[model samples]
Target: HPWVGDHPLSPKSVIRDMYERALTFTELVSHYELARTEGIVLRYLASAYKALDHTVPDDLKSEDLQDLIEWLGEMVRQVDSSLLDEWEQLANPEEMTAEEAQEKADQVRPVTANARAFRVLVRNAMFRRVELAALDQVDELGEMDADAGWDADAWGEAMDGYWDEYDDLGTGPDARGPKLLIIEEEPQNALWRVRQIFDDPNDDHDWGISAEVDLTASDAEGRAVVRVTD
Candidate 1:
């Protein structure tokens, strides 16, 4: 419990190493909470889709769950690339300068920062994806569980019980967290996704950008959120 401990840590005792760890709860909780919430919400969305017989809701004919997952992937990378992190970094942009930003302008960043930034990115992405995929315009901004008809408690339990592939993803499933969360054992969503490229090879028409691109206005056209119907 001491902010600054005087003793050194030994590996033999499980509790001994906890005291010397540098995280101090402050840095770790935010990231974990974000990942937990997003993970829970994603499972919730899956339950909703299942309830609807795996069909794209009439409101979502313009786009589907797959579109949203890809969108989340791009946002996760942006977070990793350090494009969005003031919330996780707890830094003030007015104080930060263009020159300093340039000096630290590597496309890649430390994983710790990326993990937390991803939470923020994915949280908003989940909300926006719903709207973009909706068949009709939604009246309200939030309050999705009640509107979209998801079993929140059941999905939350599923997330809590999730100890599969994600355990293998040391840093937590990278950018494809939503995709990773789905089950692949059956000839369903997951397997269908694996065969999408083969089903429509050279059919990159809908996805904003199937791969990475420069963060410029010219690339903006490719980065735009997509809507798929039929």
Candidate 2:
């Protein structure tokens, strides 16, 4: 097939548009991606593009792309106050079998109806965030995962599994109470987490924990000691 002319909607233009969208859509995407089916945000954007013009990227088929658009339209319609409840479920995991967890997520996400492309995008996005969060927690814990009974691939699988189990379990402002940040005291292995209550229901919460050898003598009493057991 002959190459399309250097028109406004050229291949190069499409590629650039994809890149630009990635950057410009970061914040809006962070909100949605952090919600559920983050990739749905991207797919929704792609669907919007398809609406403006007939062509979609070579990597994505028209039907697959259109399905994403329709799915997003449904999301736009159904999304409401209940979104918060769903978010809460994601933040706090309730005891459930893996299959049951997935079933619950499917109810919120509707895995059966969405196209493969949209699903792939959602999974990819969820995995990405889970990996980053796991890595960060690992660093903070200073615990060796090499002996955690998993290889690299296995580790990835574990993280993905955790994400699948909880990512879509619920939605809303976090109800996990306050995030705990443990800081080490002068005594080796002695650690304590800062206790703080969250006042605002809508505000996002984050806390940092670092390995500390010691604080002033007066500060010792203020910092509570935490013990970890097998």
Candidate 3:
């Protein structure tokens, strides 16, 4: 199929279509295949962007290619940074012959492109709020009081038990605390745990907590909105 569908094949449309295709492939492919595919896609995207650069109206060109330009610039920066790091390591000569260093460098050098594309894909997915429910939370059980004589194993066991009971109790809104919308999912669990501690009536510890928790969410334009209540 043509990169751009029935729509007039303008430079902007072509670039946008290719980007969409690249993101789709990124999600579908394995890591090894992704690396090769990313290289090809990056080259295609670069060419498309170059074409757009010349053909786009002077008024709209900058705005049209802004994000794409940023991504390409970031890619170059990452590649350059990786090359510098490899060169510095080679200069240090850590018990390796010239051949070994070259081989190591070669293995690592191709990582930047794939890594960049994957990062872009993740960033875009997160911005678009894709599969928000599928994103895993990073549960942070705060450090236990050492004076209580709880060792690491004991603390772990206690946490496991707590979570087990928590799960058994249906993990409903009351049990899990109020739902708060955050930009990313990982921080949501940690924030929920903190809110629970803040709201616990049985807890005697003075946390100097606020009466209301301020949650954050993104607007349709991807702008941050604070003071969001459950």
Candidate 4:
């Protein structure tokens, strides 16, 4: 009596109702497909990198010696040459020459904090998508060092591996490949589905505390076309 009178009914009902409605794989897939993305990846980073697309060079992760050099060259090309030269001067304990400091400041392109951070994220994503172990170790402070921070050899190897793997798979944007989309971006649809499931009194049978999960894959309007054998 105490438990019934004092205990909150909402939480208990929520949990119990979910327990009763054991949604099958078909239902899950249907829900996800209703709100799936049109492509394998989101276009946020791809859009950002589009500016460099023309000059970005065709980088299919590097494969051989030429590829490694090409990747390195791409990285260097994106950087203002004077920035590195100035860095060399400032790295030493000795005072930086006025010309060197001025050049560095002047050569500094308009890279906002957000842009820099996003580039780092894209780089990390590239490493991850390639299954490079080094991706896990890269950090914000470590990359800031410019010269001593990043290992060019390791990067080259990762680039090579990534491209090599891609080549073996024979995949490209135009290539025929399968893409599986997941997640229901719209909450309202999912919420409505859950409500319909929970509102059904037959979701959980009280006779023997048994649960009835919809296992059929048919697309019917109502329960009139369905039956339970158990």
User: What are the per-model numbers of colliding residue pairs?
Assistant: 4, 11, 0, 1
1-230, model 2: which lDDT tens digit per residue?
12222222333453334332222244444533433444444444444544433455555655534544444333332232133234334546575555655555455433223333223222222222233344434342322233433335544554455445443321112322113222222334232223222222234323111221222321332211122221
Q: Select the stronger candidate by lDDT from 3 and 4.
A: 3
Deviation in angstroms for 80 in model 1? Answer: 12
lDDT of 3 by residue, 1-230 (tens): 34223333344654454343333434323422445445544445455544544556668855325555544433332333343334445557776777766665555333223433433433333222211111212121112123324344544554454444332222223222222212332334322111222212333322111111112222121211122121
Q: Regarding TM-score, does 1 or 4 come out ahead?
A: 1
Residue 78 of model 3, lDDT score = 35
Quantify all predictions' global Cα lDDT against the true fold. Answer: 0.29, 0.34, 0.34, 0.27
Query: In the order shown, what is each candidate's alpha-carbon RMSD?
Result: 19.6, 21.2, 16.4, 27.5
Model 4, runs deviating above 4 Å: 1-117, 120-230
Candidate 1 overall lDDT versus native: 0.29
Q: Candidate 1: list runs displaced more than 4 Å.
A: 1-107, 110-113, 133-230
Candidate 4 yields a Cα-based lDDT of 0.27
**Candidate 3 overall lDDT versus native:** 0.34
- Across 107-212, the per-residue lDDT of candidate 4 in tens digits comes to 5332211232222222222222222222323243223222433354444543355434333321122111112111112233211110111111232311110111
Choose the strongest candidate by lDDT. Answer: 3
Q: Could you tell me the C-alpha RMSD of candidate 2 in Å?
A: 21.2
Q: Global CA lDDT of candidate 2, please? A: 0.34
After TM-score superposition, the amount by which residue 84's alpha carbon in candidate 3 deviates from its true location, in angstroms, is 17
